[model samples]
Target: MLNYIWSAIVLLSVVCSIFLGKGENLSAAIVDSGAQTVQLLLTLAGVITLWSGIMKIAEESGLTAIFAKIFSPLLRPLFPNLDKESDAFGSITMNITANLLGLGNTATPLGLKAMHELNELNGSSDTASDEMIVFVVMNTASLQLLPTMLGSLRQTYGSNAPFEILVPVWLSSACALSVALMIAVGLNKRKRRL
Candidate 1:
């Protein structure tokens, strides 16, 4: 569906450019945009790689274990079904930790691992469990403490103060996470009652 939508958008853009007598300009822009996209990807890849290494080191050094311990109290109630020592819980902790440090690219694999672990715990059920829905909501509206990815992008684009958006990022993410959790929990409770 998304592929079709993108194809339609590209087709529309090409048609508009031809009608507006800007085909050459559009072609030039497309080439330039591709180069820019590659440059941006390389820059982000460097940042993400650095952070991923740090996260791995943290894991090896038992820092992530400490993080899991710290987060356990807060997460326990939210994920009551997940055992504290389970692989799913560990992946969730790592994913949440990566997100808090603004390592979104780094968190992707962790989130996937967590979801897979959750699915296994769910008896390989076709329907998503309450815990799975809550976990998804948490990830979707993850609160970032550092916004490192955004900062890296801003820096790459020549921003003088890349981290200046910290307060707004915190406020917005916190609000989103809060609302998402509330809705997910409410729905889960409603499902339980039914």
Candidate 2:
């Protein structure tokens, strides 16, 4: 469905360009679009590599483990079904840590793994458990200490201070995350009442 929509949009744009006697401009636009995509991918790759390497070092130095331990209490209520020392907890912590650092590309695999583990604990069912829904909400609204992706985009666009958005990002993310968690908890309670 999305593919068809994109195809229609491109076709319409080309027709409009032809009618405007600017058909030649379409080729330039397409080339520029492709170039921009390639540049974005390269930038993403570089950022992911740098963060992933730092994460690996942190793991080797036991920093990741320390963080997992520190956050275990908070994570317990969110993932009550999982054992406190489970690998899922570790993966979830690492994933959240990566997200807070704004290394989303690096966090994706770990998040998937955490979800997979959570599903396994649920006997691999098609339906989502309460914990799974809560996890989704938490991940979606995870607080960010560093808005690396946004900073990268700002830098790419030649912003004078790419990292200047830090304080606002931190405050907004914290509020959003708090609200998301509260909503999830309320829904869970309402489900129990039903």
Candidate 3:
């Protein structure tokens, strides 16, 4: 569906450019944008590789375990029914850790693993459990301590202070996470009453 939409957009652009007698300009813009996109991808790839390696080191050195321990207190209430020693909970912690460091690509697999484990704990039911719903909400409202991807993009585009968005990111993520949790909890209670 997205591919079809993009193809239609490109087709329209070409038709419009021909009618406007700007075909050469359109061609030049397309070539320039393609080159720019490749350059941006390379830059982002390097940043992601560097951060992924750092996260691997942190994991091997037990840094992630320490982080999980620290975060457990805060995450406990959100997933009250989950056992601390369960694989689902552990995966959830690791996923959150990856997101906090702004390693979203790395976090993806962990999030999926967490969800799978959560589903197993739910007895592989068709319906999502409260914990599962809350976990999804939490992941969506990911709180990043370092917005590495955004910073990389900013730097790639020539920003002097790429990480200057830290405070605003924190404020927004905190508000989002807070509100999402409240809503998830409220809905769960309401559903139970029905």
| Model 2: residues with Cα > 4 Å off, grouped in runs | none
Worst 10 residues of 2 by lDDT: 79-88
Candidate 1 accuracy as lDDT: 0.92
Global lDDT of each candidate: 0.92, 0.87, 0.88
As for candidate 3, its clashing pairs are none
lDDT of 3 by residue, 106-168 (tens): 787789999999999999999999999999998998898988888888888999999999999
Q: What is the TM-score of each candidate against the true structure?
A: 0.96, 0.90, 0.88
lDDT of 3 at 186: 94
Candidate 1 displacement at residue 141 in angstroms: 0.3
Q: Summarize candidate 2's per-residue lDDT along 77-190 as a digit string, tens digits.
A: 887777767777777888899989887778887789889988988889998888788888888998999989889989987999999999999999999999999999899879
Name the candidate that leads on TM-score.
1
Where in model 1 is the C-alpha error above 4 Å? none
Q: After superposition, how far is residue 78 of candidate 3 from its true place, in Å?
A: 0.8
lDDT, residue 192, model 2: 73
